[model samples]
Target: MKIGLIGSGDVGQALAHGFTSEGHDVKIGTRSPRENLVSYSDASSFGEIVVIATPWSGTKAAIDAAVAGNFKDKTVIDVTNPLVMRENGPPELALGHTDSGGEQVQRWLPGAHVIKAFNIVGNAFMYKPEFPHGPPTMFIAGNEGDAKVAVTRILTSFGWETIDIGGIEGARLLEPMCILWVLTGVRSGNWNQAFRMLRK
Candidate 1:
């Protein structure tokens, strides 16, 4: 599958590598292609699916520039969190409680089937994560069942234990998982930790 990664940042590049390593073609959509990226429109046209990896602050503009209509009926994986860094201390969520970045992305691109995933974990564990216990669990939510299924297939390929927690509104819960993930690293200075679910 041709994958459109709609950001040139770390998340986008990491996912690009993961997708390519798995035999899928990837094109990164960014403001400048000269910096090893593709224009949003070109990347959208080149892919069968798209990934939204822009920082929460630039998400709206990035989607707008990517031509929202072009994503109609396409599966879009939203890998964003609404945290903005403060001038003083730790970053804070820009939107939450009542709304979330994933839901907002769905609103911006109404025609696209948006699924929220990869926002709950550090990028280091995103592709082929190895743990002493088992694969880390990934939680995803989306309105379209088929879209969630598509993301599940991709996640399974990349090595994750997927747990579908329901519709897009579930992002309200999933996004916070990122805060917990980051706080561990911030408080302990260890980025090697990951969360795994236990079930009998």
Candidate 2:
């Protein structure tokens, strides 16, 4: 599998490394190309699966730059949080309750299977995370059944327990969960935590 990552930030790089370590060919897309990074269009065209890891502000532009057709019929993993940071305090969701980044990305690439994932945790744990209790749960939201399955497989490979929350609209819930993660980190001053779902 060739994984194209649309954003060379921490999240993208982390997932790219994980994919490569999992024996998949990985390409990172960026505005500034370098030895390891390729242009967004090139990366998108090169991948069997595309990951959208761009910051929320530039996600649309990155997708546009990658060419919408390049994502056609491909599984697109969205790891973005639509945040508006401030100097005074913790960041807040740019939009929520009715709209979300995942739905917007789906709208942007109607031909692509956009799945919202990896946004609820920090980049440090995006790949293989070790915990004393057990593998943490990763909640994914997407409309396509096959795409969600694919993402769940990847998450399992990266040492995660997954729960399919159903449809891209579930991002409305997942995105806010990101805020909770952040606020918990801010208040507790611990960045080394992840979420787990308990079953009785």
Best by lDDT: 2
Candidate number achieving the greatest TM-score relative to the actual structure: 2
Residue pairs whose backbone atoms clash in candidate 1: none
TM-score for predicted model 1 compared with the true structure: 0.96
**Candidate 1 local distance difference test against the native:** 0.89
Candidate 2 per-residue lDDT, tens place, 109-200, comes to 99999999999999999889988999999999999999999999999999999999999999999999998998999999999999999989
Model 2 CA lDDT for position 42: 93
Candidate 1 per-residue C-alpha lDDT over 108-155 given as tens digits, one digit per residue, 9 for 90 to 100: 999999999999777877898888888999999999999998899999
- What is candidate 2's CA lDDT for residue 75? 96
